[model samples]
Target: MTKTKTLRIDHVKHPMGLLSVHVFWCVAFIVIPLLFILYYMMIDGNGSLTLDNIKYLGSKEILRCFGRSLIYAAASTAVCLLLGYPLALIISRMPTRRQTTMNMLIMIPMWVSFIIRTYTIKNIFNDNGIINQLLRSMHILEKEGDFVKFLGTPGLIIFGMVYNFLPYMVVPIVTSLTGIDNRLFEASADLGASPWKTLLHVTLPLSRAGIISGITMVFVPAVSTFYISSTLSGGTVTLIGDKIETAFLNESNFSRGSALSFVLMILIIISMLIMNKFGDRNVEGVAV
Candidate 1:
C-alpha cells in the first residue's frame, strides 16, 4: 500500500493595513461630515446652541412640505411595487439567455445620466414636443399649441418618481425570486396547490426581504428628491428636499437646512424600522 500526502494551506486573514485604510476613509468622509452637520443644526448664527431650529419643523409651510414629501414617496413606492413585482416575476421565469437579455434591457436606462433621463422625459411632455405634436397631428387637439398640460402636474411628478426608481424595486425582487429553489414549486404543486396559491404561500413569503429592501431604496430617494420635482414641475411644486435646498443654497441658512436634513433622516429611519417590523410579522405569519 502506497501512502499519499495531502497538502494544506492556512486561511489568509484580512490585512490590518487594508482595515485601517477603510476606517480612515469612513471617519474622514462620513463621520466628520455627519458631526459637522449636527453641530451646525444645533447652533445659531451667534454660534450659540439653541433648540429653535428643531422647533421650526412645526411651522405651517415646513409641515406642508414634509406632508407632501411623505405622500409622494408613498405613492411612488406603491406604484413601483405594483408594477415591479409582476415584471420581476416574469423575468425570473425566463430562460438563462433571455433573462440576461431582459435584465440588460430593463437596466439600460440606468446607464444614462439621471439628469439627462429626467430632461428627456421633460422634453417629451413639452408643449411642442413629441406627445403634444403627435396629439395635434392626430387631431386629438383642437388646434395648434392645444397640448395636454403634463409638465407641472402632480401626476407627472409621481410618474417621474416611478420611472426613475422602478429599477431599484425590480432588481432586488428578481434577485430574491431567482434565488428560490425550483424544487419548492414542484413540491407545492405535488401537494395539489395551485399556481396562485403557491405564489401567495411560498414565493411572497420568501421574497419579503427583497420587498423590504426595495421599499427602502425607493422611499428614501423619492422623499428627498429635489431635482426631479424642480425640473419636471417647473418650480411650481416643492418637496421637503426643495425646502432644504432653498434654505441652504438660496437663503444661505445652513442651520435651518441642517435641522431639516436631520428631521428627514429621522423620518427615513422611522420608516425603515416600520418596514422591518412589518416584514418580520409577515415572515412569522407565513411560518405559522
Candidate 2:
C-alpha cells in the first residue's frame, strides 16, 4: 500500500500529466475557436485555399490597416503607461482609506457605458464643442478653426484608447507596487540613493510583471477594437479590425474575415512575445 501510494504520487507529479491538463484547458477555450475558423476556411475559403486570398491581404489598403492598428495599439499602451504609472504611484503612497477612495473613483468610469462615453467624447471634440467654445471665448484661438483637430483624427482615437485602458494599467501597477516592501525604498533612501535611482533599481524592477500585463491587456484589445477608432476617427482610420468587419459584412466573406482575424491573433501573439521578452528580464523577483 505504501509503495502504491508513492507510485501514484510520482505519476501525478509527472510533467506530462500537468502539460496535458494545460493543453486540454487551452483547447477547450482558445483552440476551439481557432479550429472552427480553420474548418470553416478549409470548407468555403473562396472555393480553394488559394494564394489570391493571401495576396489580397497584402494589398496596400489591408497592409496599411494592419500597420495602423499596430501603431494605434502601441501608442495607446505608451499613453496609458505614462498616465497611469504616476497615478498608481501616488495612490500607493497614500493612506489605506485615501487609497481605497481613489481606487473607487478610478473604477467608477468603468461602470459607465462605453458607447455612451465614446459618443460624449465625440461631442466634446465636435467643431462646435465645449473645448472649441472655451478656446474661442478665452481668445486662445483666433477662430474656431483648427483648435485641436480632436474629431476624425488619430488623436481622438488615441485619447479614447488611453481613457478606457488607463484603469487597466493602473490596477496592475498598483497591485505590483503595493506588493513591494516599503522598507526597501526606505533602505535605499538610508543608503543615500536618489529617488530616481531607487525607482529605477528597486520599484520599477519589482513592478515589471504588472507593467507587462497592463501593456498586453491594453495593447491587444486596442488592436482589435473597431468602434472606438471608427467612431473617433469618423471611419477614416483604417485598422485591421476595420478590415475584418468589411470582410465579414461588406464583402460577405466569412472565410476572409476569419483569415484576417487569425492574422490579428498572430499579431497579438507576436506582440505578447516581444513584451514578455522585455518583461522577463526583471520578473525574477516580481510576484505573479
Candidate 3:
C-alpha cells in the first residue's frame, strides 16, 4: 500500500499527468457544454432531428438582425480604432509613471458595473435628464416636451458600445506601440522620411497585431451584446443578440437559440481568420 501511494504521487507530479488533468477538465467543462449546444441545434422541442432551426436563421427578419449586428459591430470597432489609436500612441510616448496613471484612468470606467453604467447614461440622456435640463436652463429650447432624443437612437447605442469597450481597444494598441523598437523611427528619420511618412510606414505595420486583437476583443462582445442595445435603445434596435435572446428567453426555443449561436460562432471565426491573415503577414521587407 505504501509503494502504491508513492507511485501515485509521482505520476500526479509528472508533466504528462498535468496535461492529462487539463484535458480531463476541458472535456468536462468546455467540450461537454459545446456538445449540448450542438445537440440542441440538431433537435426540436420534441427531441426529433430537424433542419428547421437552421433554416429559420436564413429568414429575412433574422437576416436583418444579423446585418444590424454586423453594422453596429463594425461601426463601434471603427470608432474605437479611430479614437483609441491616437490615444494609445500618446500614452505609449508618455513617461512610465504618467503612462501607468493614464492607463488606470482609462480602465476605471470598466471597473463600474456595465449595467449600472448603462443606466447612468440612460439618466443623463433621458427626456428630463441633465442635458435637457441644462439646455432648458439656458433657454435653448422653448417646448417643454422637446428633448434631444438621445436615448433609443442608433447613435447612442453605438456610443455606449464605444464607451464600454474603449479600454480594450486602447490597452492592446498601447502594448504594441511600446513594444516597437525606437531605432526604427530614427532610421526612418535618417532616410529623410517625414514624421507622417514614418508613422504611416514604420508605426502602423508593426502595430497591426494589436489593432487586430483590439478589433476582435471589442467587436466580438459588441456584436453579441443584448444589454447595451436593450438598455440604451429600449429594445428598438434588434441585433442578432436580441434575436437569439428572444428565442431562448421569450419563446423558450432552445433549438433556435443554439442554431443562431452556432452560426454566430462561425461568422466570428471566419472574420478572425481573415484579420489574423492580414495581421500575420511579414512586414520585414518594407523599405526603411
Candidate 4:
C-alpha cells in the first residue's frame, strides 16, 4: 500500500502594515480635518468654549432659520416618498430594456453639478423665466410675473430638493422592489390572496428596508443643504446648512459654527441610528 501525504493548509492573516495604510489615510484626511475645524472654532471663540456661543445661535434669525430648515426637510422628504415610491414600483415592473434605459435617464441628473441644477431651477422659476412665458402664451395667466415669487420661497426650495433627492428615494426602492422574489407574490396568490392584498401584505413589508434607507438618505442631506436654499430662494431662506456657511464665511465665528455643525452632525447620526434600528432588517442593497 502506498502512503499518501496531505499538504498542510496555512491561513494568511492580513498584514497590519497594509491595514495601517487605510487607517493612516482615514485619520489624516477625515479625522484630522474634523479636529482642525473644531480647533479653529475654539480659537475663534474667546480662547475657550462658552455658553455664550450657544446663546448667540439662539438669536431670532438663526433659530428661525434652523426651524425652517427642519420643516422644509420634513416636507421635502414627504413629497419625495410620495412620488418616488410609485415611480420606483413602475420602473421596476418595466421590461429589462426599458428599465435599463430609464435608470440611465434617472442617473443622468446625478452627473450634473448640484449648483448648476439649483441655478437652472432658479431660472425656470424666475419672473421672466420660461415657465411664465409659457403660461402667458397659453393664456393661463394674463401677466408674465404673476405668482413668480416661487423662485425665492420655501416652495421652490422644496421643489429643488424633491428634484435633486428624488433619485435617492427611487434607487433604493427600485433595488428593493426588483430583488423581491416574484415567487412570493405567486405563492401569495396561490394562497387565495388578491393582487392588492399581496402588494399590501407582502410586497410593502419586504420593501421597508429600502424605504428606510431612502428616507434617511434624502431627509438628512436635504436638512443640511445650504446651496439649494440660498440659490433657489435668493438668500431669503435660512437652513442649517446656510447657518453653517454663514458662520464660516460671513461672521468669522468659527467656534459657534463648529458647535452648530457638531450639533447638526449629532442630529444626523441620531436620526440615522433610529432609522436603521427601525428598518435595518429589510436592507438588501449592495454596500459600497
- TM-score, per-candidate, Cα-based: 0.91, 0.83, 0.93, 0.86
Model 4 C-alpha lDDT per residue in residues 101-206, reported as the tens digit of each score:
9888998998899889988988988877888888888888876556545777777889999999999999889889999888988999999999899888888888
Which lDDT tens digits does candidate 1 get at residues 1-288? Answer: 111211122224534444555677899999999988899999998999998898898899899999999999999999999999999999999998998898889899988988999999999998788999999889999887588989989899999999999999999998889999999999999999999999999898999999999999999999999999988998999999999999999999999999999999999999999999999999898788
Would you list the clashing residue pairs of candidate 2? none
* Local lDDT at 131 for model 1: 92
Global local distance difference test of model 3: 0.89
Best by lDDT: 1
lDDT of candidate 2 over 158-234, digit per residue (tens): 99989887898998888888888999999999999999999898888888878888888898889998878888888
Please report, in order, the local distance difference test score of every candidate based on alpha carbons: 0.90, 0.82, 0.89, 0.82
Local error of candidate 3 at residue 14 (angstroms): 3.0
Ranking by lDDT: 1, 3, 2, 4
Among residues 3 or more apart in sequence or in different chains, the pairs in candidate 3 whose N, CA or C atoms overlap within 3 Å are none
After superposition, candidate 4 runs with Cα above 4 Å error: 1-11, 37-46, 58-60, 143-147, 280-288
Worst-scoring 10-residue span by lDDT in model 3: 1-10
Cα error, residue 188 of model 1, in Å, equals: 2.5
What are the per-residue Cα lDDT tens digits for candidate 3 across 1-288?
A: 244444466674665654665677889999998889989999999999999998998899899889989999999999999999999999999988999999999999999999999999988988899999989888898877777888889999999999999999999999999999999999999999999999898898888878999999999999999999888997788888888899999999999999999989988999999888766664544533
